[model samples]
Target chain A: MARLFKPRMLALAVLAALASRAHAEPAAAPARAEVLHWWTSGGESAAARTLADAFRAAGGTWIDTAVAGSEQARAVAVSRVAGGNPPTAALFNASRQFRDLVDQGQLTALDDVARQGGWDRVMPPAILDAVRVNGHVYAAPVDIHMTAWIWYSKAAFKKAGIAAEPRSVEELFQALDRLRAAGLIPLAHGGQPWQDSIVFRAVLASVGGRDLYLRVFRDRDPRAIESPEFRQVLLTFRRLHGYVDAGSPGRHWNDATGLLVAGRAGVQIMGDWVRAEFSAARQRAGVDYGCLPGLGEHAPYVIQADAFVFPKNRDAATARTQALLATTVTSPAVQVSFSSRKGSLPVRSDVELPSPDPCVALAAALMRDRARQLPNDEMFLTPDQAGAMADVLTAYWNRDMPVETVQKKVVAALRDDL
Target chain B: MRATWAARAALVPVALTALLGYLGSTLWTAQMSVTASRTLPSDHFVGMAQYVRLFSNERWLLSLDNLLLYGVLFISACLLAGSVLAILVDREIAARGWLRQIFLYPYAMSFIATGAVWQWILNPTDGIQAVGRALGFSAFRFDWIVDPDRVLLTIVIATAWQASGFVMAILLAGLSGVDPDLWRAARIDGIPTWRVYTSIVLPQLGYAFATALVLLLTGVVKLYDAVVAMTQGGPGTASEVPTKFIMDHLYGRANLGLASAGAIVLLVTVLALLAPFLYARTRAAASIA
Candidate 1:
């Protein structure tokens, strides 16, 4: 009995020592950050890892909590924040997606970081406006994705005998006609509502012009929506629906991109992310494929951005970690590495690309012209309003809704009361 | 008295769970429905405005219509197919266990898997239509999955295929419980087999049928996964259901008030439909007691 008691006493002493060590470890430990994002795809995960590696290199511990879909990730982040166990940082669209978080004071303002980093002069105005709310920088803009780009398979275009890229809305239709005549699918379109909205925005920006597009989306003026020019934009948008094959409905966007990759389809109106798909297929842009930022010379460049917002925390250590992440994300070097891997334009245009892809070069060139820059609909409208407008557009795209009726529906969808 | 007190004490945790876990959250949701809550729940009351908006919203209305259409078609088809399969298996065919396994297999798989398989099978380019065209039928057209008008039908086909097997399992258990003497009497009376099933056998399985109906009705109300997996309520929100709408509003759209309102309406609808059935079931139980 004395021998057993002696062993137990020694065990207790050891356990107490371990517990004390655990209690003392937090003070001198590195800044630990848990970042939640939705970059689960192959290329996306690689891009996300660059930021994580950079943060680790900056003397912080990076913990990745990747949820697959953006909506699911944001849902998890919002719930965690509301439940009072928020991550250090969470990814969100550089839009009105996180406005509620800001309004509720659930996010820590990164004003000091922004000031130190000179975010005001470096970040694009559209992205800056999105991340800055109530004169406080609440998010770090990582990359700018031009959402409305016309991606055409060079093989399909050659087969269709189209010589030059369409310079105007009329010429675009003529190219579609040629592609259709070649017996290939004229358009590789996914019939999802968001994809439909991408096509609609492309038409609105290229056909309706910048002023009309702003009036319709930004100003939400009913007069602009009811105008003849907007009607023509709607008509062009709907007419493109005819070029999509019957198999288009319920198809995933990646599958649509796969059609272009295999040269079974001519053109796909999608974001710059499609370049990643092309790259994965070993297709070189401007040789195997071509990306048109917009159809005409002066077409508006519709841009959306992915950003990271730091959730509010009272701990100074956690705040330091958040600041480290914000700075690392927007730093010129990390931005180039991340955006290059992700096939997106770096948020800071002041940074030169080491070796930009042709599509990125074009986007970079277009980015230099501030007047050509336009924010995507998500930037101008709330998520709910944007979803409502998407529903209207998708219904019109699938069904034969009259353009006049659709215009009224669009007006109603964008109402302030809604 | 001590035993009774112990029994009551044993029920305390369950009581607390029901009160707090279920009732508390439901009350919270109801409170949120009347407020102008967006991404977060706020106390700013709007007083039935969300319900008003929900009723007027075209997507919500269309979702309701789709749910009703899908529910009726799915429930009826499941019942009919299940009853027929049960009768077929009740005849004591050889390899009955294997037959039962084959029929019950789909029910064991998740709705997500079932929906995905059916999505591919119904796809126009490389699915059954393509197969048919390959087999010398050039004019074959089975593109309902992509057609806005017929997309919902594809969902019905996939989900009904998944659920009918479950109904069969339940009804088969009931079929086994029917007294052998009744079958002997039907056979002795020169009654046709089909008549025996429709008239005598089915009427006696009323309890089992009610149980299956309740389960299937609840499944219908919670019809989200299959729709999400197959059509994503797409081809232009053509196959959208109430549950999917509420989920989208709750998370993606960040309209908590509207989502809560939709949830409450869905709950009320389910309760209204099930109340009479439950009343009758309790009455029948009380009469037996």
Candidate 2:
């Protein structure tokens, strides 16, 4: 009996040893993390590579899964999570995009990492608010992007005989006329829904002024959407459509930038990401191209941030890797380096920016003014409402729909469950 | 006794697959459609509100309308084009084998790349319009892709180009299966060529035509990639279809309840149209047997 018991005890001992070894952290294994993002564009790719390099330097593995468009990438990530296999981290625009993820308990709360890194003191309130969910940090914001920038080719402006940037809506229209007469596309436009919405928001901020813009988009007030002020903004947005080339429909943002690069188009109202396109074409900022945040000095600068969210998982190794990724993404060096290349500003206002391209530096400076900073519509409205608004805006731009009809439609859409 | 258990064992995989994958998912989706699900399926039931919203949505209504148009046009065109191609190939046409290969080649390429290529060819700037202007025919305008009123027509043309080959292949198989004796008998009867084709050949090819129609119908319902790649349902949602609308709500807008309701509506619509046709076919087969 004693001999039989001895053999059984030996078998149990061996099984315990194997179990401990399976779980015991291998002191030498690198923390491998796979990141999914839409930074596959040439410049965005390089910016992502900067983060990869920093992560590598800190002794971690970086796996990239880049999808071209942000919406496409996010969709793939969400599907992956639903399929029970999610990436270590995924890139998301700083908005209400991850609200569903948090609500479903799919995101790992990054509050511990946020506290450890002193994120509250570094990041601006707006940016922090964008990444926070229910008093917990659910994402690590990487860069801040100003979406309402007017980009123009300096050479085209010179040929058009416009000496300086237009300070008013009327002057801007006159400049467009001069550009048109000079045999260039008055506005380099991509007639995609998002692109049309970006122009509409810029017009909203510049013409409708910030309060009305906020009331309609942020507050989603039906009265504000129905007001004459919103109608005027819509009309101005529609008027700009006339300046666009016939080929604007289905054109890519890069193609629009290409028109500016080749001096075929005079101006483009686009996000600061256009700066990367100019840089890629070997055009110098302030020399070959120029930027205007808005027509007026007090025009609110619309801000959108790109963030990384870690998926919740039970695996200890995966959780540890996620925590590490959250820390690395918000590291000051990574933030500065990524923003410098990405044509966006750093999320943390306290971080000293590296010498960015001239356009990025200007955007960074503009971000410094508190009054100029305004969260993008996604930051306020739910993704559903934002998509509905985009549909309305694009439809109005494409068709000769009456302004009153558009106003009524806008009000009706906003009046749906907020 | 041995055969009974073995047969029952063989049935297990199909049972498991249908129960877990198909029926399970359908039930889950139907449940979620009742709730105000966003991003993920939620248990918060909101009754028939999502269906109400789906019916009220302008884009959704337009998508349904476009799907109907696209369905009728795409299927009929594919059938006609495929039959014509098959008939020509079966005749004493020169280089018949090479022609068959050429017609079938487009199916090998991804629709994403094909759609982009088609977009360029249809664009007003550098496409048919530019070529027309270059040839001194300035009045010629083939920019149906950009014109909102005619964008869906361009999609139809591009989709037909990709799909007609598949239809042709199916019809060609049916054509080959035709007994040579029938043609010889028709020749001896002094029947006209068109009469032989219309009365004899076409009636025999009914099964092939039915198969093509059903396949094309499925393709029409699942038509999302081409629309996304070509126009992205744009020109102010003029070309939006039900599948793309459901997809937009599914992930982009994070409104799964609305998306599910839309899917259920689409499924029910397809079932309503297809059920009687399928039942009639089955009944005819049983009666013939």
Candidate 3:
């Protein structure tokens, strides 16, 4: 009885101490903000630290919660928000990902912050449209990522006797053939579903043209899916699968990029994130490697962005902290620093990169031409629809399905009723 | 004797936790399955729609097929390999402890680590296939990890390697309990050692085999981590399992209603498979009493 009594008394004493310490904290404790993001990789975390530093300089406390994978991070953020203890801010792709949160009144609108920052003038129209839902802004745009870049190893190209960059789909195939003849892996592809869909998007943008791409993805027109042009795009996408090595299945995106960095593979159709890998290997863009936004001169530029949304919080101090974070991340100086380190284009067009990278410069040049600017499918499709479409595309990519059957599957997958 | 009131009072918290935590959440999930829940659960009733969509989903159907194939192969391989290992270890070997540790080491590692190691070993470009080619065997090929039809088999091989060790330990424990007098009697009767093992010793290990089967079956149903660490339901969804499907919908796709329906289906499957075994066990116990 004495032993039990002593431990219980000690536990009560500890609890009393903890409660007193909690009560003793100053009422004006620096407006604390916990930012949830999926940026734990070396370069990505460095980029995220810039935002944390800026927030600290702005007289607010910055708590960083970095989850390793985007899907997992968003899952945690969503569940936390549902569980009623959401972070001060959580990262999301600037797309329909957070549309449900807005519809459910779970996100705090950022109209005041948007107006103060002149977001209407600074942000590109595509990104601005993504953040503004029902005449109120719900997300703060951070960086722009173009998804359909063709990254190739110059060493592999030269060894395969390719003289210049392929400017058309026909020329790209010829280059792939030359690389294969040289006994090299022609395509450095990771066989994950998302990576497979990236290749499909590149093919759709280059082969199907902007109109067909929009019709198939944005409009979800069944006619567009079954058309001969779309079939040709599917055929081209599958044709490139022949160039991949036997070890392509389940290979990670970075490992695939490593192939190009090592000059073992000729080309990889991925997003601008691959630049981080090349740079990590000390390969300079336009020197050791080259990036083409797409195969054709006027191919559609499929763009996506990483942004932050403030989960609805009733606390006045937290609201102020959230607004401060929004303004700090979107400022011109912060945008430039974050984008340069993160291998993405700055969300604000007004910012100037201190030292421009060749690939980013190319993307910036393409961004100015509003005629070629297109939103990636994620911006238009709900998360569920996007996943379903990915399933069809990946199945088609890995299997020997007929083009007509694939078209049927795509139409079914994109049906809004489901 | 009746349990004391103090003991019953002491069990209140645990009893309440079981009733509310497990049973209550299970009921909530069933209710959610019948609603039009997406990113968050809503009260809007949409009966049978999510289940309809789940059944029609090609990925879900393929996942079920893969789970079936994986279940049969993984369980049989683990049982056979475990029995052989237990028999081998039961002999009076000089390095019994070392052999036991060596066989059981993989069970100590997480499925993720085991999956990663096996993935590297089975990769065609730089794994065993490359070594075979390097040794002047130009025609050698073992690229099943990337083949759409054969990727599920690779998962079976990986998970079986991780779980068979555990099954071996169970069987070895059961083997140790076998009567030494029966062995002496068999020796006096001049019965062969292999015959004694097959005809007499194995029959006595029924409870151990049942326990191992239950563990292996649950492992088969929850076969997500190894698949994720290795194939991630790819070479185009060929290695997908039911748990992976439910998880993808639950979080990544934000279709909670469909995910809940999948969970209920998996629960029903497990209950159906375990019912007869549990009933038989109860009957056997009652007869012994």
Best by TM-score: 1
For model 2, residues B170-268, the per-residue Cα lDDT tens digits are: 988898999999999999999997788878997899889888888898899988878877888878788889988887888778889999999899888
- Name the lDDT value of residue B62 in candidate 1: 97
What's model 1's lDDT at A211? Answer: 97
**lDDT of model 1, residue B7:** 100
Candidate 2: residue pairs that collide? none
Model 2 achieves a DockQ score of 0.46
Worst 10 residues of 1 chain A by lDDT: A1-10
List residue ranges in candidate 2 displaced over 4 A. A1-32, A59-68, A80-86, A112-118, A315-324, A415-418, B1-11, B177-182, B185-191
Tell how far residue A128 is off in model 1, in angstroms: 0.4
Candidate 2 chain B: 10-residue stretch with minimal lDDT:
B87-96
DockQ of each: 0.49, 0.46, 0.52
TM-score, candidate number 2: 0.91
lDDT of 3 at A22: 39
- Ranking the candidates on DockQ from highest down gives 3, 1, 2
